[model samples]
Target: MAASMWRKMRTYVSRKNIHRLIFDPQCAIFSMFLLLIAEVAVNILVIKKIKYTEIDWKAYMQEVEGVVNGTYDYTKLRGDTGPLVYPAGFVYVYMALYYVTSYGHHIRLGQYVFALLYILSLVILFDIYRKTKRVPPYSFIFMCCASYRIHSIYVLRLFNDPVAMFFMYVAINFFLRDRWSIGCLMYSFGVSIKMNLLLFSPAILMLLMVRFGTLKTLLHLIVCAVPQIVLAVPFLLENPVGYVVRAFNFGRQFFYVWTVNWRLIPEEIFLNKYFQTALLILHVTFLILFFVFKWRRLYPGVGFGILMKESPTALSPNQILLPLFTSNLIGMSFSRSLHYQFYVWYFHTLHYLLWSTTQPPIVKILVLGVIELCWNTYPSTVLSSSLLHVCHAVLLYGLWYSPDYTPNDKNLTATKVD
Candidate 1:
């Protein structure tokens, strides 16, 4: 009787059915929920153990207030030395928050709001992954279990980056859907939130030119600039040069102790004015090389026609979405001033890329494992600045090239037909 029962059970569980079960969305959702719970527990521990009172709540509150009241002066707020740093649209979001909270007194309330944004970002990331056809269920599960949630917690204390990342993802979503005009508008909104995104503007322009051709692309680009122009009209009229200087040149003037790469090299070398000039030149040169030499050849027009040749059933919209997503993630990694929370933006992108590739499973696991470990260490405060910077630079550089040479087609289809 026992042998008969075992045979029946084995017959009922077919190999094909088991494979289907493994890849099911229900399984993925359950796994993500458990991972989220674990992450929240860890965050609670980190917040409780750390001295939360050490944060500059008063200064943050004052900035929040300044952003709410349009009358608040940037020069006075920055002490006449620092640039405005943030774009004007950020003030609008803060103003909305202020109104909602009725200008709440407690700083912890602001922290909680930031935390909710972090959670919303995670949900957006999952949507990006689900929309990408080439991504595998297993890979998505791995991302859910990774260090992305931990990084979000670190960003919760610093509100600006979370808001910036949210807008960046919004821009990416629009771009994926072939809405270039809307994408550009979202990109402008993102830059307004944080000037750091300006680094990726060149890449954005290149993508627009490629997708829409010359005249139309130029027109769209101009349209996108409208927001910035309107926001700056007041400052521009008051002092054009000063406004330009504050908007563009301010970040270049001051060096922060928390800057990652500066600590890696010799202090004397990093401190020299010539060193900054040389570094700027080097970064620009490499960025140009990436676009002109490496990226151009990787796409369809440059003789990789075989790679670009669409699958018989593949939708053009899907084909376009993959590249759009790739460009955004690569752009973010190349950006300067990438704080810890910015990792949330790329988690889904990384998973999609990994799932689409044909690389051995072991290699994927190793690379992702290392990335998670590095992201988790960042908020620990145990690692030296030099080490953190080195790790960040290396990981980002590695990620940019990883999907380029791989042979996965998960991102090539509009939807999973199987």
Candidate 2:
């Protein structure tokens, strides 16, 4: 059995095979072609004709108009929507779009531009996975193809979510290389676009904590947080109460009846302030425990050495990052109510986490089926909502406990491509 295992390992990482893969341009071009085709087809067939006319788009367009005319007032832009819920940095996207459409109020044209940006977002995502070289090419391609929720977030809704996501992933790619300051700056900018990017804050915090001292980590976090503060200053100056209400409106009641997280629970229970408080407390506690466990391998050699004696201090940081990314995103999914559009925030990363596991094919399929069913349903049903959270919990549990790759185990990563 030992000999057979050694033989399989050798075959998986043979130097000769790695060299051949490095020069495979045909494979790279084929992958890019397929990705482009998928993006174009989805935009043309599904998104263009969808009659939903996302209410959110109307609100965003109003803000865009206000900005372009030099009369931008977040407090009064979308009267029906209460106020602009996002930071002022997003005004720039609409400003550019407004110019592109020749101020003809061409919202559909803006959607097309957003669709292109979304495609670029996926390209950056693929590049990140390629740099990590852990996910299989076929699996990465499959996840990219299956991202209908992400597609809707982009072309169908013409959301600010994708713009934030594009920034977040670009930051992740930088952070993966230990470029802490630049990554945090990008993350900060993403947060400025839409605060939903804060869902991944714990992951960034964990990564920073693992590599640097507390003082440096704190400094970096402050640097990261500065952009959002600066962006909000003008809005706050004009209408302090409005800015406060809109920017940090977590306690606001859900206006929509159809939601992913709260759909399974009774409506009263879902809306209860106490229930929300309990979830927040539990989420914070779970995150603290997660952070501690992640630092176990780096614990002091003075007194705790015996406890983590078997843990490898020399292991690559990606092992820690994968869990940080998985746990926080799953935490976000369950710790708060998820609207129909929120799925895009973590779907791609969640798929990567799912496939990273050694779960059986049947199990992965069933889990994916449950997730897809939940998101694909327009008005999410009770069963789909319940299963969605259940599936998230399962993925979080599996990723939390999954074995980390050792020096030998990491040899199983995808081969380099030239």
Candidate 3:
């Protein structure tokens, strides 16, 4: 009887039925339950070792309360504390949390809520991949079981990166379905949460323009701007310049030790204004060259035919561009004063991009295993700055070279799996 049952189970899990097993609600539920337990264990370990107060949760709470009470002064905040760089929508999230936690006195409650949100974000991400039907077998499972480096940054450290990434993922999901307006709104909301998202704005706008044409794209952009405008009304009326300068220009230079590249360069280089200017110009030129060459190879269009041809569908251009843009942004962030927790931003994008490819399951597993090793070593002394720089460079290069599946592909059938 035992031998017969084993044979039956093996037969049931064959390639043809794998999809059913993978997407089954019961499977997802069980995976999530396991993930929750693991995450809770990790969170407990981190909080105990690092100490809750050292992570800046209290300062973040104070900042949010300050914004809610209308006593928030941007200029003063930036001067006295570090940059108050997050968007108004982020403030709202914190405010809601504060209200529920009774002004953050209930730290455990806040941590629990963030933990749940982090888990929910992963579920939504899996749903988005499942909707594509192109997600390789075991991809979602790998993502769930991967190291805590990225997810912990949000859940344990209590940062807004996860929340912003959630919006980005939602926006991409809507965009994939050709829901341009809603996607644009979500994109706008993501940007409103953190200016880091501004890096993706141009790509999102390009996507809208390609999908809806110029006039309609402009109208959609206007509509998308409404939410941000409404949220900024008070700040705009009070001290527009201060808000703009603080929110936009907060990270204009490098000062912190946690920033990645800054640690590599000499202090003299960072202190010199001209050196910074030169580095900025060099970085911009390199990125432009990379994109130009990439585009020329991937999609070469005739004059009028370009507008008429359908946009790339194997993961929209935005999906392809986002990971690259985010990697570069993380590089830039590291070149400035990046906190240890800020590494979450890059790892999240990197891990997602790795799993999203059409590569074989073994290849995905191998790559993720390497990344997991690196991530696990990050907090320890084993992973040095030079090692991290190389890893990041490799991931960014992979992102740039990875196929995003344009509509121009001859093999793409009418089923449209992307």
Which candidate number maximizes TM-score?
Answer: 2
Using lDDT as the measure, what is the rank order of every candidate, best first? 2, 3, 1
lDDT of 2 at 36: 68
Question: In model 3, which runs have C-alpha deviations exceeding 4 angstroms?
Answer: 1-10, 14-53, 76-80, 131-142, 271-275, 296-338, 355-383, 399-418
Better of 1 and 2 by TM-score: 2
Q: Please report the TM-score between candidate 3 and the true structure.
A: 0.76
Residue 313: error of model 2 in Å?
12
- Kindly indicate the candidate among 1 and 2 with the higher lDDT: 2
Task: Please estimate how well model 3 matches the true structure, expressed as its whole-model Cα lDDT.
Answer: 0.59
Write one digit per residue (lDDT tens) for candidate 3, span 294-397. 43333334122234434443334334344345434534533444455555555445545654455555665676666555445533232444455565555555
Q: Lowest lDDT 10-mer window, candidate 2?
A: 305-314
Each model's RMSD to truth, in Å?
6.1, 7.6, 5.1
Query: What is the descending TM-score order?
Result: 2, 3, 1
How many residue pairs clash (N, CA or C atoms closer than 3 angstroms) in each of the candidate models, in the order given?
3, 1, 2
Q: Estimate each model's TM-score.
A: 0.72, 0.81, 0.76
Q: How far is 19's C-alpha from truth in model 1 (Å)?
A: 5.0
